[model samples]
Target: MLETVRRQRRAAALPYPQMTLAVPVAIEGAALHSGKTVRMTLRPADADHGIVFRRIDLEGGRDVTDIRVRHDRVVETTMSTVVGNAAGARVGTIEHLMAALSGLRVDNVLIEIDGDEVPVLDGSAEVFVDRIEATGLTALDAPRRAIRILKPVVVEDGAKRAALLPGDGFSLAFEIDFDNPVIGRQAIEADLYDPCFADDILRARTFGFLKDQEALRAAGLGQGASLENAIVIDGENILNEDGLRYEDEFVRHKLLDAVGDLSLSGLPLLGRYEGVRSGHAMNNRVLCALMADETAWEVVDFVEASRPAYAAEREMLAISAD
Candidate 1:
């Protein structure tokens, strides 16, 4: 990603630095999909290990799954993204945690989950970001790597559309429309170069129309979602007892979700992304298209940096290329 190119380390000026933590951080809460309580510990991983999920609740059950988004494992895209291996073991609605990791610029992690889904804590990545930020960031001996899409790939479902285009840095443009007066049409475009961008949009909660509640519950879904964690809307009104975080929070929240979903790439993506009335399905389609095109991507290592401490941190990264 372009962010690494500007990294202030001549000795550590490498593109991707294997990153780790000075200490481990623990987070406890409820998962959005499985609707169960969870307490997870986040430990530093070595370079190339990327991100992984470990299920400790299963005495001998095979619940662990890698967070890396791949073409073969995306199982659902209706309300959330569900990823798993051939065995059908998976994690659901991983956007919030993904947003938190990407927001804090964390490239590698080992997530130990006690339940089927990540806690829907506050319906935002802020909590996760705060907890992880407290642990701080350390550099690795290597530089950071990026996913640079070499060609334009687009996916569409009727009026909905999502696409990835070549770009120098990571960027996103999202637009949503709801005929309801409370959240009519809203849009946002961001170049994720500033660290504060995530802080600005990452905490907005997910929202839904009141009319859809019954159908959701009938299908045994959204049992855990409520005003406390999401912005509920009824007809033309916003249903949360509390007010909106921002007048245009609907769009901001969408961007937040996109940030987390895009993180499936394992490496930070280096390109421009656009979504028009897009959701989990469309987003996954874009990634699938990229993977389907072999010429669209390549793997490369970092070559520069001026920071010795970061260089030392890079050495600490514990991932393998394969």
Candidate 2:
């Protein structure tokens, strides 16, 4: 019985599986911030060929710029992290793509876009995950390399802040306080190590304060936004017929964004994150801070994920949860 138990335990540790987006998929939808209609396609990339965005609408009518999920190419950390190239052909509102790829642990992909923003389908990573699943995933012959946070790295903007601290697995604890009654003072602590974005966080749509909707529209934004795609909140009301995906969904959504944004590091970070009213700017700041400091992290040679795991490194985020 003792030997049997030992074998079972070892087998249980066999390793987490590997998956990839099945094939190139074209997606059309609206952007979260700009609310513009976008048409894009997903193409598979070779191993170590991290997530890259190509603006097909550019002058050359090709992928002139490929913004990688690394620290150096980060151009803007505003309403969202905007990564651009020397020619400035950029893809906006990338948090959703980043979230889906990072949350689902997809390492290599090339996202070609015709519009300026990524499609905000369903307002969360669910649609992207679903599309990916529909496209199908297959294992590759490469070992995965994951980033393990060795210590705490914190960044602040006024009272807004975000912090990453060493932990056994990746997690996020967030707190948000809004004056609006519909979503006021919400907090969430999520364990990404267990990796349940498909249920707990993926379906939670993006939200906005009603008072700002018209103002945003007036500014040439939110043109395609509706209750169908986002949470419309008044002082004390939910504009949507449905209430919410979670009781404290706002904070969970924020944490989801953080997970996606931090993934820009081109590595699956193993850490616990805590934030309060921090947005893309602060999030990128924290990542830049970590990159600037050598003590914050070290390059991993290999991730011992599962049974048929590869030996050499180069595959990104292979050991995401395990």
Taking all chains together, the TM-score of candidate 2 against the true structure is 0.85
lDDT of 1 at 135: 65
Query: Clashes in each model (backbone N, CA, C under 3 Å)?
Result: 31, 2
lDDT of 2 by residue, 134-225 (tens): 66654445655677778899988778988988765577888888777677798887766443556787667788878888888787777777
Model 1 over residues 98-200: C-alpha lDDT tens digits?
8778766677788887776778888888788778766676676666787777899999898898898876557789999877899889998776655457667
Candidate 2 has its poorest 10 consecutive residues by lDDT at 305-314
Candidate 2 overall Cα lDDT vs. reference? 0.72
TM-scores for every predicted model: 0.86, 0.85
In terms of lDDT, the best-performing candidate is 1
**Candidate lDDT (C-alpha), each:** 0.74, 0.72
